[model samples]
Target: MIMSTIFPEADVTEGLKSAMRLYASGVTVITAGQGAGRRGLTATAFTSVTMDPPTVLVCVNRNGQAHDAIVENGHFCVNVLCEEARDVAESFAGMTGKTGADQFEGFEWIETRVGAPAYAFAQAAVACKLTQTLETASHSIFIGEVCEAATNPDRTPLLHFNRGFHAIGALK
Candidate 1:
């Protein structure tokens, strides 16, 4: 349920935003490399669209640096963060103030078919080529054709909720 009682008002958009924060989502580090080298950002708005055409979509804030980078490069890699990669997510989220090669640091990464940086230690990674871009008021939804994808069998996915990272616990 949406818990409507907490957001019952005509001008409660901010309140609804705050309430939406309670919904947990998997974290992803979306990256692209081009003349600007590599630019990426942590995101929680990625989803698979269709398996037939192997499509996936990610919503990026229109003002973010990576938003234009993805458009310029026409490709990107979705690095699904693992439970142990909270700092990685935070780093890509601009919390560290590091940019360019400095941000890559000790992470093992490689260029893929789409020329995007793929994380070697990601719980899951999907390389994609941009197919379409749909602009909404505050964000741009980028639909991509998945060119490659893989998942690590032993890792737990990282989650974001309530403006914080949550640990993944094993089910009993």
Candidate 2:
């Protein structure tokens, strides 16, 4: 089977959406801040990039506020959202467009080693030190070294798929 021969790209929107739907991945809240100023956004475009030094990458929309904050702070926290965090995902995804303390209201959080706010209720939290930022057309690829990591014992990750948040059902 020649995989390259399958042609599709005329309407990239539908193709992109369809492709993403079939590839279900965990959701995350990418955050950047210091002191009293903090910004966060819901992101699923995160992945491990290296193992030797424990590095990971996150893709952020170039125009997003979180991207700008990260650029200035050179730090971030990847809070791996758990299955019960659908509301937290929605809040950060602009469902309410709440800013400042309002966005973080009612959520339990703690400071990372680098002092960035991270969600404590998450299944895992990977605190990263910004290593590099590469600019693309509409997004910036952020590479970071895992400075600190912690996991909660009883939590399943939240997954994004088909333009919605989905939790895995019981297996047959």
Candidate 3:
């Protein structure tokens, strides 16, 4: 087994990233804006915060193109990817070398009540209205109140771990 230790004076950024890669997480594409202004990005930093008001949070890099669109639109949709949507994930992640509206060219998207675009074939989609924003050094934590949601139960979620995409297998 391999382990890394962080010292007080050591830079922890790379270590932190390396450590996080071992943690498997569901993949998602967060989208915001409408029409010509639409933007989306592949992300895994999303979680449900509460059930009371159906709140959720997504962490987006402040420097990402979709970041400003999310803030200015005041809404975003978290589209949980299914295993079959790996191409969609790659496109939005800039792996296809497409940016902005181009990233959405080949996929069908539906607009939620809050005006954010949601992937039509996602495993699940949660539409949220931006309620709060907490800024960190390099990212903003977007806290949202879920306004609408949809799901495709037959599909299994896409997951990321060890720098690769994976699908669920039989239970241990």
Candidate 4:
């Protein structure tokens, strides 16, 4: 049922990534835990699965600390970023020389009732409790039941397209 005209003439990894890069996806920082155990990862692979029970899913690298924390803590917060939060994305993505506690150094965060960090500046922050997980290849698809969601309507979301962050207003 695949319907794409572009055939891979080179390496599949590069081909697939290049193809997917053409998609503009919202940026979110998946955060879990607090204090020294705090961990977050920059993710573009998050989306809603259902609305009746308010469920969502996010994919995480199987070996990432944030993935481990989400499992151990049984909760996570998806902090959807604004354009100004690109450095926040980079820090969580390990571009900065910071990890764990150091990665969260200067940001003002509000810990949710589920015990996960929700960024004050995020366009939207969703607190969720992990409900299920499916492991496939190198990543785990975590299914979560949303407990609470908040948004800053005045702030525009940050999106990733062609491997760079773009503000949402460029299109609509």
The best candidate by lDDT is 3
Q: Candidate 4 has which clashing residue pairs, if any? A: none
lDDT of 1 at 7: 52
Question: What lDDT score goes with residue 38 in model 2?
Answer: 83
lDDT of 3: 0.93
Better of 2 and 3 by TM-score: 3
Question: What lDDT does candidate 1 reach at residue 122?
Answer: 93
Instruction: List the global CA lDDT of all models.
Output: 0.87, 0.86, 0.93, 0.90
Please give, for residues 14-110, the per-residue lDDT of candidate 3 as tens digits.
7778779878899999999999999999999999999998999999999988999999999999999999999999999899999998999999999
Candidate 4: list runs displaced more than 4 Å: 1-5, 169-172
lDDT score for residue 21 of model 4: 87
Q: In model 3, state the lDDT of residue 70.
A: 95
Cα displacement (Å) at residue 119, model 2: 0.4
Q: Which candidate is the best by TM-score?
A: 3
Off by over 4 Å in 3: 1-11, 170-172
Give every collision pair in model 2: none
TM per candidate: 0.90, 0.89, 0.92, 0.91
Order of quality (TM-score): 3, 4, 1, 2
Better of 3 and 4 by lDDT: 3
lDDT of 1: 0.87
